[model samples]
Target: MSADVNTGTREFILPDLGEGLTEAELISWKVEIGDEVHVDQMVVEVESAKSVVELPCPYAGQVVSLHANAGDTVSAGQALLTVAEAGVEMGAGDEGDGGTPASVSQSGSSTENSSGANLIGYGTSEPKTRSAKKRSFGGKHAAAPAVPTVIPDAPSQPPAETPASPSNSSTTANDRVSPVSSPLVRKLAKDHGISAKSLPGTGPGGVVTRADVMAAIESGAGAAAHVPAGTSPAKASSPAASSDQSDRDTRTPITGLRKVVSERLTKSRQEIPEATIWLDVDATELLATKKALEARTGEKYSLLSLVARFVVAGLKKYPIINSSIDTAAGEIVTHGDINLGLAAQTPRGLMVPVVHGAGELSLRQLRDSVSGTVGKAASGKFDPSELTGGTFTLNNYGVFGVDGSAPIINLPEVAMLGLGRIKDRPWVVDGELTVRKVMYLSFVFDHRACDGQEPSEFLTFVADCIENPISLLPEL
Candidate 1:
């Protein structure tokens, strides 16, 4: 049904989610057509490359229409929905039939009117303008002609159809804009050498989807057919192509967080010249200290929290490890505040949640921060901010029963400290061999950021602290 015809309608465009993200997959819409929505109320949920986020409505009004459906990928600055503010007069051109104003263009093009809607942390708004002459794929439902004014109590009659001509068809093809919701779908069509504008979309409002592009490929409308007749088709059957898919019974498309992780790790390896150093430390004292503390205070003190304290202390002495290399500027960037990122594994994938101002926190505070952040990450409730801005990373791969690993350096950060499993090992104490708790500490650092001297000393200092837990008492 139509909203109040007298009310002015404002289109809400999708705001840019941070970290240089250009688009997001629309997970679901919280509001429906004709539903009333309040300012700052969550109206939609979207899955970005990093995480899932709920977007709040910026204007208070009755929802006139939803521009994209669930599972559609939408770009930044695209119209998300229309809200007709209460008690505003609608212009003659803005009126719609059956009480619902046409919030979106029937041609499936983005709206052109600029609405200066602003959301906090996301910058200013811009209009997504469409061309004057609308184009469409061949469909049973044609676009309705624009009505300039409505006469009072006029009889509702269908507009007369105009006969199509050969010239009109040619012009339509030349001017045709694909009814695609996402840039990804368009890219798929282009990659397969298929014209999206020529394909009839089965999606709502006739929007082309990725599945449609795949269907075209399966129907022999792929890039191979578009090749010149004289060119050999050897490229398609090359050894490289077969090797790329060799022995893989099942293949999963890498998207979302996994894709982001792959890109970041790839960049890290390509850019950072890294080195790893490992040392086995006598952890008998550290384990005893934790047990003593727990018994004295009747509180649980995790070994990870204790080790994190040692890492913070070590960072204070070796600040260069907390720095990042800006290769483009040919400079080393050092951070004043230490944001400790703890790597935690969840069902979604590996995630590093950062604890801001970690160096300033006490042992108990660090424990609480680590516990809380890890809990949120495991439950998939952590914010994107928590996943970034890490000055250094603390990895406890020991939980997985590993002895040592050459951990890759987290990008923008120069180093990562890994703690391996603490187990009983024979140790020589006063010339007698005895069983003692031992653990391996693997320290990976960017050689460009600092020489071996600093990282070596840092690892030794941490090892000494673990061997003699009482040494940390002065700092505590």
Candidate 2:
């Protein structure tokens, strides 16, 4: 490794992309070797989580070599491509965001500066134009006026009143009452291209909620029709659109995170002989226990948290459920510590961030970890380690008002415990009929390594534990 050695190769390595992505699947190669590429031109599409992303080229030059092929698994810091920086008319800095486009405008909008002189480190690409024609309103329904960038304050004839800014303008797209907001709310708003000021928030300190963004989008669709009515026929002519459109639709390449998910899921289903066992439990006792625990601890507790704790406790009693079969060793490898994977549905896709060493955590600790990890995963900030190494999985489908579901086992994990909605149902108790809070539980296990008898015992243990949770902590 001599410093004086002429190393002319510029390596384009995979970036971590902030979500702590360690590995990404190559979806496709947009530019082949010998193709003249411009800085910030879209080079590839990688899926992370569920979002399909088009990665832009960071350098302007002829591609000298391709480091990886489509469908290949790539790790962060591994070279994806190589570009020769010689004889390129454009000049830019060398720093790359790993995923940020080479072209960046002053305002940070990626306007690709294909011209060599305009290239910085990477140049910004031109903004993709959304709509060129002005909005119009059709007959019988007058289009609402375009909300001006600034609204004029109403003139009031009052002797004394609250002091108002003389320069107070009307509400506009640029006007925001408060900018400090939760990242989820901001991300939701950005996804819809919505102006937050127009929304009335019901969250803490007037923070926007997920419902607010959804409502705003519903309102926009009606407003879109109204706005287009006022434009001229030539400008307002509707483009032919497919009628079979989903309410919200996006098409992304199967690359990066999505690609990995696709492959793993397929492999798991193909290779694993999985079997499911179902049990209906009377959750009334557990509900009461949860209430008592919450009151005693003076903390907010949900049934999901209680279930998580119960699952963790059950894993300890049924150690095989917490263990993975090491086929190479021809052994049933039982783990000493439990790492519980909590399946969370994110806007981009499904993510299971593990709660490390969950067997040792209390109910409160489990709740906090589950909540924080899911929140971060939804916001695309979960660390890569958070996503891997799960001995078992817990999937709560109750929030969707589901009674029970046979959830798929995450690959490498032997089982997935699905929890369903707790609802009042009539049941027999000591030869008497009674209405109780009932929840159906489904435990799906990989049957290749574990036997039917073992899984049945595991489910029975879990069901009994949930019904009699105090029995689990006698030694605690």
Find the candidate with the highest TM-score and give its number: 1
Per candidate, the number of residue pairs that clash is: 3, 27
Q: Could you tell me which 10 consecutive residues in candidate 1 have the lowest summed lDDT? A: 132-141
Question: Which parts of model 1 are misplaced by more than 4 Å?
Answer: 1-7, 85-178, 183-199, 210-253
- Report the alpha-carbon TM-score of model 2 versus the true structure: 0.54
lDDT of 2: 0.61
Evaluated at residue 245, the lDDT of candidate 2 is: 35
So what's the TM-score on candidate 1? Answer: 0.73
lDDT of 1 by residue, 1-476 (tens): 01122234555667768788877778899988778887678999988776788888766677765667676666676667767775544444432321224444433322222225546433334233433322121221234233212112224854235533446443343233446655566676776567775666555345667677778766766555555557788755443343344324344546667778899999999988999999999999888889999999898888888888999998988899888888889999988989999988877788888999999998889999987886786566578888888999999999999999999899889999999999999999889999999999999999999889999999999999999988877765
RMSD, one per candidate, in order: 8.8, 19.0
> Candidate 2 — which residues are off by over 4 angstroms?
1-12, 15-252, 327-330
- For model 2 the local lDDT of residue 236 reads 41
